[model samples]
Target: MLSSVLRSLQSLTTHNNEHQECATPGSSTARDPRKQVLMSSTTFSGAGPSVGKRLNIDGDIPDPSHQLPALPSNLPPPNATYEHSTPPQIPKYINAYSLFLAGSIEMGAAITWQRHMAQFLHHLPLTICNPRRGHWDPDSRPQPSDANFRTQVEWELEALSNASVICFFFDVNTKSPVTMMELGLWAHSGKVIVCCGEGFWKGGNVKLVCERYGIPCVNDFAELVVEAKRMLKQKGLDAVTDEEIQRDEEWAKGIVARKARKEA
Candidate 1:
């Protein structure tokens, strides 16, 4: 009778362990899918069934504070601009000639002119030389001895010299002392073009100067861009900039990768 009772107790224990291993279908434990381990029993060696990869609810690793957004499928990878990227190519003038916007800050009137250039002549994006981009201006400009000032001056000088066509804007509200200086420097070169508004403080002087030098002058800003496009047709896409060349390289790489994928 003792042996038979022992067998009955063993059977009941086995059933209890099985019930604990797999939860009931409608139990609270079954509500979360992540809660299910489904691992098998271990041997005496302390080894058990292999564990699967760790679950990633969002499939992205995050920093302590924030997670970066995943890149969208449809967009092309971003291109790195080589504007200031070095080793600087030897500055041989290639198809780099453009409508060099050589002028003073003049309350950022160049921005409005740039938009018009984009709208009217989408293909030809004029090269702009805005010296004030990286630094702030004082009421008094930086001295010629300053290294940064010298670098900007060199860049502007190069732009003015190499440009096939240049369109200058002398805004009414801005006396643009620098703009007037540049006008004299480039006026006789025949590549210079000018736009001085009606109310410009020195409009008469600018117009008279342009007339004397035979530099094309217009009263309207939009006319300046229109004239640039007309001149660009005569002057084909000159040597492209370093940034444009880098973008082309990136595009070529993408094409090659796509072709390789297809072959694979």
Candidate 2:
């Protein structure tokens, strides 16, 4: 009975060893079918490699370090048409003109001149001289009673000299003393003076001064711009098309000459 029990125990031990060998693979054995299926499904997809794994497929990913080279620094600046040995001289014969819109600061003529000048000749340098309390403050107020009026006058004279042309505006029905003074000053200084005054300004001090100084006086701002451009070309500071300049000059000259003929 004891020998029989020992044989039964040995048989049971051999069966248990066989079961353990089937449950766990040896070190050199291949992966199990379940593990191979799981790894293939999780690591390989149509969207490339899995998030954490490096892709092993042929021609699947690009190297990230290579990039296009930057442009060179010796390239010329854009929109540079010409390079001059010397700076182009400021047109002396009135390539740039300033407008001295002179009238009562609150008047319609002043407003009209400002609007038209801003619209038509916006590119030109214009200086409107209408002093007001708002423009004068603690920092830049003018001394009314100061005897330094000569200094102001000289400064204005210098501005006129620097500018190739000057323009003045006045209202015929209501002439401001300050406007008249400015017109007179520009006229006396021999600056190219163009005046835009009311139609009735024909037989007044403004008209008389314009006539005496040979200053071109017009009743319209549009006509004033045409005349100013023509004068610039006549003085040889403008190199624009001759046909255009001549057409404008003919129109202005016709108006002036006809007016003169009618007066005669």
Candidate 3:
């Protein structure tokens, strides 16, 4: 009976050992090479305590406060400052040279009118359109040369497009067919049109045309110049100053003196 009891006790001990081995994490299965390496390294290195135990070294971990303080429901209003600044004045000669001069080229009055206008507005640039010359042709091939009329008209239109202003010098005595067309084009393009002529010859048609198109017409070239200067000033270009006028007068006198000397 003692021998049987000893054998039974040994068998129970062996079964417990097998059970423990099966319960252990890696012992029952074929261990991964990497996992085995890691375990062996940990054992040899005598690694510190598990992370959980290390983190809670002092006492039980405290839970965060259940009730969080409420944030402000309304944000503070923004503080902003705005500044208003004045605009700079326009330059004196803005778009001065880029002007188109249209009129009756055949008439002497038209020439005189154009010359006066040009002289008065010397500071501004001017391009005269002569329909009689026809268009600008470098080859110069075409009969009657008048065929080039369309070419001149095209050139004038191009100049008009580039111009800041279009001044029409109309003569009531010699009503130019082309002048009306040019004026109409200028009006349609919203160009500033300044018409100049004498009152002796009835300007009813011209006056009516200007009235219909809302163009400014003046009898005197000097008055036209004044008006043009005022218009330019309003647009912030060429503000009239007494000093500038005086300077211009002095310059004119010098030119006259030179001319007189040359003539003598």
lDDT (CA) per prediction: 0.46, 0.39, 0.40
Global fold similarity of model 3 (TM-score): 0.43
Give candidate 2 misplaced runs (Cα > 4 Å).
1-109, 123-157, 172-174, 199-203, 246-264
* Candidate number that wins on lDDT, 1 or 2: 1
Q: Candidate 3 on 1-264: residue-level lDDT in tens?
A: 223323433454465346434544455322321111111000111111234322111122111211111222342222121111111211233333344556544212123354344445444332332222211222322223544433444555666676555666654343344455456556645556654454423255556556666777765344455455444444444434555555544644554455448659
User: What is the per-residue lDDT of model 2 for residues 226-253, given as tens digits with 9 covering 90 to 100?
Assistant: 6655555554534434775566566656
Off by over 4 Å in 3: 1-97, 107-109, 124-148, 196-202, 239-264
For 1-264, candidate 1 gives per-residue lDDT tens digits of 222323433454465358446787677644532222211100001111112421111111112211111222453322222121100122333325455666534323222343333333333334433332322222212446655445556666776676677768754544465566667777778778777767665677678778887778876554555455545645665433445445434644554455448659
Q: Give the candidate order by descending lDDT.
A: 1, 3, 2
Query: Candidate 3 has which clashing residue pairs, if any?
Result: 96-125, 97-125, 135-151, 135-152
How many residue pairs clash per model? Answer: 5, 0, 4
Cα lDDT, model 1, residue 198: 70
Instruction: State, as a TM-score between 0 and 1, how close model 1 is to the true structure.
Output: 0.49
Angstrom error at residue 101, model 3 = 0.9
